[model samples]
Target: MSKQPASYRPRHAVILAHPNPASFNGLVADAYCDAVRACGHEAIVRDLYALGFDPLLREHERPGTEGFRLSPDVDAELDILRGSDVFILVYPIWFGMPPAMMKGYVDRVLGAGVTSAQVQHRTAETVLRGKRLVGITSSGASKAWLNEQDQMDSLRQLFGRYLLHAFGMKAYEDLHFGETIEGLDQDYVDANLAQVGDRARAICAAIASDRAQGQAVPPAA
Candidate 1:
């Protein structure tokens, strides 16, 4: 009798919302997953655009509806997220915000399958609670200019902090690369990818420490 391979319980999830397979966002996603695996931890990748994911939220599917339900896609996404402690989002910022695809993912997947109907429902159950969020985003504008205009801070507040607080996640970290327009320099790309790899290693180390200490993180509100 042949022995089956050991089960894989993914610890990190890398989600990409880039339309082009060869885009920088795709490269970042690949680098992240590879780095996580190199650190001896499992990581799952989800390419929303490549999978033709539906970004629309139908009226009937609204939360607390008479018959609120999640579509098969959302269910699958949630299932993947359930086992993950770290979620890394890779995308290109457009018009000072994440692309529509990423926004849709936030609504359909990160929102979780079901939420309590009443606002201020202090005890609502959420699968994403205690998880950590990291973001790798690129933009056509320069990073200094964006920071000068307070756009980066805006994004950190609106996307990272807001999501962290809303979902009860543990932490939020965002890294941005600017001047990513056409004819971008290869050196810039390499530098950013190196940083991405470094971040993955750091996160993996932290997760390992938590596991070793038998930390119990959950039901955060």
Candidate 2:
């Protein structure tokens, strides 16, 4: 078990994308929050469905336009994302991708003039530099099947590499919980949920390690 720095308690933001509270994805999110709290950190759980997060990006929320504006909901989520040191996304995979609400959350909250900025003669500058990302995805398919289909590869590329990198985040861990609802037995599901707790602890440990190494923590916007 890794210990947090005695001086600082990192804030963790856990975003729950599944609509059903009884779902396995929700259980994972709950487990993560409990583990984060056990690590002596603050945990904020954003339940997208319960909050009624609008999945559609309205015209006003579009980027690179004069009249572009953010809704209060989007602004709030962005603030949470910026303030937290560790970001965890818990969602169920639908058709080899995150559900619509999670995708929309990424689309709206991670928009320009908020999480990133374009620079001349350089790659897009990300305001979310130095933050850590963890993705917890549940799917009905088996891990072997997902690997054979390259679904895990796609997730790693999209979220762990491309998306997080665009946000200037370098540290990431992607955890896949397959055969979650229908195809798996209770014991296997329990094991995956346990893994979620373990991963949460590991995330806290990594943050403490980074701090001990004098890594710069990104400033909140």
Per-residue C-alpha lDDT of model 2 across residues 102-185, encoded as one tens digit per residue: 888777775445423542222544335667888888788888999999989988898667766676675788898777765457
Q: Weakest 10 consecutive residues, lDDT, candidate 2?
A: 113-122
**Alpha-carbon RMSD, candidate 2:** 5.5
Cα lDDT tens digits for candidate 1, 35-101: 9899888888889998898988866567867878888888877877786889888999898899999
Residue 185 CA error for candidate 2 (Å)?
3.7
Off by over 4 Å in 2: 1-7, 112-127, 215-221
Best by TM-score: 1
User: What C-alpha lDDT does candidate 1 achieve relative to the native structure?
Assistant: 0.81
Q: Mark the regions of model 1 whose C-alpha exceeds 4 Å error after superposition.
A: 1-10, 113-124, 215-221
Model 2: lDDT equals 0.78
